[model samples]
Target: MSDDNKHDRDTPTWERETLQKLVLATVREQRASRRWGIFFRLLTLMMVFLVVWAYFDFDFPSLAEEKIGPHTALIEIDGEIDVEGTGAADNVIPSLNKAFSDEGAAAIVLRINSPGGSPVQAGIIVDEIKRLRAEYPEKPLYVVVDEICASGGYYIAAAADRIYVNKASIVGSVGVLMDGFGFTGLMNKLGVERRLLTAGEHKGFMDPFSPQSESQKQYAQQMLNEIHQQFIAVVREGRGARLKETPDMFSGLFWTGARAVKMGLADGFGTVDTVARDVVKAEDVVDYTQQEGLPERVLKRFGAAVGEGAVKAMTHAPIPSVR
Candidate 1:
């Protein structure tokens, strides 16, 4: 009787210890799983942060670190001169002021390489260049054309004290043109109805889908003529006796750099480096174009992503530019 009881008790105690060990093992396994899960999550978060940081790291050169010693202040006007862009009034005006005000800057070089864009933008830049030049009469501003300086490009160039160009550069499309497609014939063929509503007469004057009236056409022509005349006056005044004016001088005619010099569209053939050394008499050149930083651009893009719908609603597509 005692042996049987002891055996039964021992069996139950061993089974219970085995059961407790199993429970402890299960708990350890669950804890290990939670720790691994947290590690994976932290690693994933770190990877995502690194990816975002690397994507925005463009490493653009900073100009503030450079000292304003005796040098040619260079502000490049690259790409289309739009109302708001890299080389617009906001960027160019400030650069011009800094260059003009610099006591050590021998001269300012406006290195332009553009096919031209908005007349309004160009006009604004030209006005600012003139003002800065007048304010700092001692500091001469020269335009050194890279590729093609036409339309609005020429408009800005005319304001400079002198204009230089590349040997193969295209210059002087001294004209204003407003271009658009007339979709009436296409709509008639495709049977696509155009339902445009306007409050004022000639509000849809330049609407592609609507038919243009004779008076509307005449009024548009007159406006273009006025702009063209303004261009002519600027060119005539800038070039003065140097310009070889003909019937086609102000007729949107373009010429090569060599021919441009002959036509007085450009002063002569030269590059930024050449003009800086010879004309400006300053070997060292300092860029004054205001550029955006990587962090700032990233934050701006993030903000824009958050508010794109609002910006799109408020903004209107500008009319066909009369360049």
Candidate 2:
């Protein structure tokens, strides 16, 4: 070895300096490991706390809260009246029952903003409203139309004690319809044939790819007329002497709120706030609309996706609806 290298290797402080550097490196690694362990522990605890909070908070408004004071109970129908939508009978009936049963509710207001939907769903809701109104004769139930309350919406409103609306709102359209696309011509152009086999003669009735039979068409019309008559009876029973019978009233024609009142289809022009304050004589409004929890919302979304696919595959039968 060279003379200078040998002298440095023989120095007394070289071993002491090397040992000190190694000790410092080990200390820093231990500190970093401890910090990460604490961070992970805190994160786990936070997740647990959130799950517990959501579990306890998932519920409708309590009855005790509803009895706090006198207020106008508001139930909103804001979408298509179908089994899968917010305006479904399942959702509205419970809310109506709750509002009617609440002792502190001076009156109940149904705020409707819908074009319309299933006739069956609307009929069920209308029936429930009639029952509630009869059971709670002291408390009145009113309807306040928003932008548009037509067809199925108007059907429900007919059951109310009074129907209020804005002059610009589109009201009425007491009619039912079943619509679908015909693909026979398109299939002929493409030189494609639909070979559908059914056990019953009328099993494939109204199939879009095939010509509709005269007998099936007449049967469908008869069924619709029966439902239409039922609708007319409900409206007459609910409106009593207020309704002015017109030839075109149940011909699926919609009118403005102003014209509706003149025709005796609506009572007067008013909004949710005015009806609650002036008509019900209660300024405070408590929303009794059913609020779905997080789990329900997620499940419904998934279910809707699957249900839509299934419905698309079978488009032969067009269910009657009001719109």
Candidate 3:
């Protein structure tokens, strides 16, 4: 063979191998790019989903409607008034602040339906309402009792300028109560020992495992008396001379709406609509309650159920009854 033909044969083989290698390298590079693209797409989708969820959770629309004229804000106080529960001061105070601060809001109506819980929490709310009323003298605050408003619930209602209750509504439990079950007897029966340690003598004064001492009982009673006095002061200040300081008024006794009005514990027997229309001069009442969205409500319900089930399983006891 001639030198040119030999060169051509070698060059063709080399070029064929180079082309094959180039094709393989391109395929590998395409696969790597495709994998990265897929990963980024998935990450972007996840980020979008999270953003949407957060937006819905935190950006819930206001329950109240915007009105041009003087608006009546309906601030609902439902459930137990504890520090951690749905009727917590932390939850209700913000809504109350918003209602009072709204320039369009002519008056605030506290629509209460609670059996009451923490005295401190109720006091905090009552003080805020008083302060807000003093600051915004133009706007009046009213309480519309629904179903029941007793104990700490009445404490909050008494802070309002006036109170309205339904005819059969239960009202006026103006006393403080601290309740805890003593497990000493039960433990004795079960032969379970309670080992409690504290640095201070009075640290465990209210311990359920130990029998209440005379000194401890006296101290607790004094504290309760002080709290009761404070509650009476709030009622007197809020209701002014209108409140009849009868023995029955602060005797931890509840009364029906008719009797409550007679006793001066309530101003009148009426519903929210009646109060809003007649008292506030606005027929339309706007509710500014902070309600959770559907998804959040579902999640909270599911989580609470799971937690309650787990607790029941661990303790082998029924869930504690609501106060």
| Candidate number achieving the greatest lDDT relative to the actual structure | 2
Better of 1 and 2 by TM-score: 2
Judged by TM-score, which candidate is best? Answer: 2
CA lDDT of every candidate: 0.80, 0.86, 0.80
TM-score of each: 0.73, 0.82, 0.73
Identify the runs in model 3 with alpha carbons over 4 angstroms from their true place.
Answer: 1-68, 186-193, 292-323
Roughly what TM-score does model 3 have, to 2 decimal places? 0.73
Cα misplacement distance, residue 313 of candidate 2 (Å) = 7.9
The sequence of per-residue lDDT tens digits that candidate 3 reaches over residues 186-232 is 99999999887767677676677887789977887787888888888
Where does model 1 exceed 4 Å of error?
1-67, 293-323
lDDT score, candidate 2, position 212: 78
Q: Model 2, stretches more than 4 Å misplaced? A: 1-57, 60-67, 301-315
Clashing pairs in 3: none
Steric collisions counted per model: 0, 0, 0
Better of 2 and 3 by TM-score: 2
What C-alpha lDDT, on a 0 to 100 scale, does residue 31 get in candidate 1? 100
The Cα RMSD in angstroms, rounded to one decimal, for candidate 2 relative to the true structure is 5.2
